[model samples]
Target: MSGVQTPSIDFDAFIFDLDGTLLDTADDLGGALNRVLADANVAPVAEHIYRPAASNGANALLEAGFGDKWPELEQLALRQQLLDYYAEDIAVHSKCFTGIEQLLIALEQNNIKWGIMTNKPGFLTEPLVQAIPSLSNAQAVVSGDTLSVAKPSPDPLLHTAEILEVDPSRCLYIGDAERDIQAAKAANMYSATALWGYIPSVDAALGWQADFNWHSPIDGFNHI
Candidate 1:
């Protein structure tokens, strides 16, 4: 997973999970949670404390930040507030993982289609995708709300493949979360784990049984 191997990129299309797989959005997400916690007079959580939860979205971030002091009754409002603060400066600290744009450009150069399928809601996904100019080149962008179901449900991945006009069997799905591998398996696509993404632990990621395990976007680029 660390050293790049010879290229054997046969997939017709590549579908990626937004948060951790392609972009490192932990600081922006963790920063948003800290802002929310500050409003509640709670202490800020460090990146190490909440980084793993970045791929799980805002709810997990709030949980990591507030811990036992989490306000269950105001959860919904607090979630919205965290989102508002995040949207105000969505890509302020977010950027593609090393070699992501290079990999993307490689895919494009080879006439291979690529897209994003994230559990992030459309509202946040839209601006965040826009803020990162490289992402605008995606052939398809499917948010959690794009369909009734999201990852762990194959629907979103299938929809992304549909948009790219590629068969599910010909798509390579890469992500940082277990749900991503599960979705790819359910969708009949090849699955790869982004080891460099916001994974909780390497043991848990290896347990996901991905077809390929990439230690970094550079590994992915080499594959292409």
Candidate 2:
């Protein structure tokens, strides 16, 4: 057989998913929810109770934590409470995952443009990213509210690439959810699954078809 050769593609930029990809934000989010529950005179929800559903946003947390007792009339109230609580305690226990700092510094040192593309709503997404010293200088950050469509639709990823002045195909997108892979695929970008992030048991790789999979942020450094 003839010797095989692999095609080499140079990546020019990177797009990251906010919650699970870069930050270990579950603790902050859970604390916010528990605060809201306590203020409502409800029993505090276990911090780990919301881990699986954290990436789904406030509604999921409320539903999972309170179920039918989450009164619609208090929806806005509870949401506001959670937001306020989270904002003040945003980075208290939240921190970059192991090797994330080094990876970010490496990307910067290499002069590679990197940004965030997240399904997180602007209210939480913007503040959380801004608070992270490492991501303070990000090239771009596209949130769920930044576009009419979110992940699983190519709009956000495409928008992020455009804002970063990078070609979509030359950008690498890393995320822990199927929607993240779907968005990257739709944008014609290279996609990788972040195995360290918050993927639920029901989430399967068959739907995502990521271009690659890395167990941690450092593992992605070489590929990027």
Q: By TM-score, who's the top model here?
A: 1
Q: Which portions of model 2 show Cα errors greater than 4 Å?
A: 1-9, 68-74, 202-207
lDDT of each: 0.88, 0.81
Name model 1 segments beyond 4 Å from true. 1-9, 71-73
> lDDT score of model 2?
0.81
Clashes of each: 0, 0
Worst 10 residues of 2 by lDDT: 1-10
Q: Model 1 scores what on Cα lDDT?
A: 0.88
Q: Evaluate model 2: give its TM-score.
A: 0.87
The alpha-carbon deviation from the true structure for residue 33 of candidate 2, after best TM-score superposition, in angstroms, is 0.4
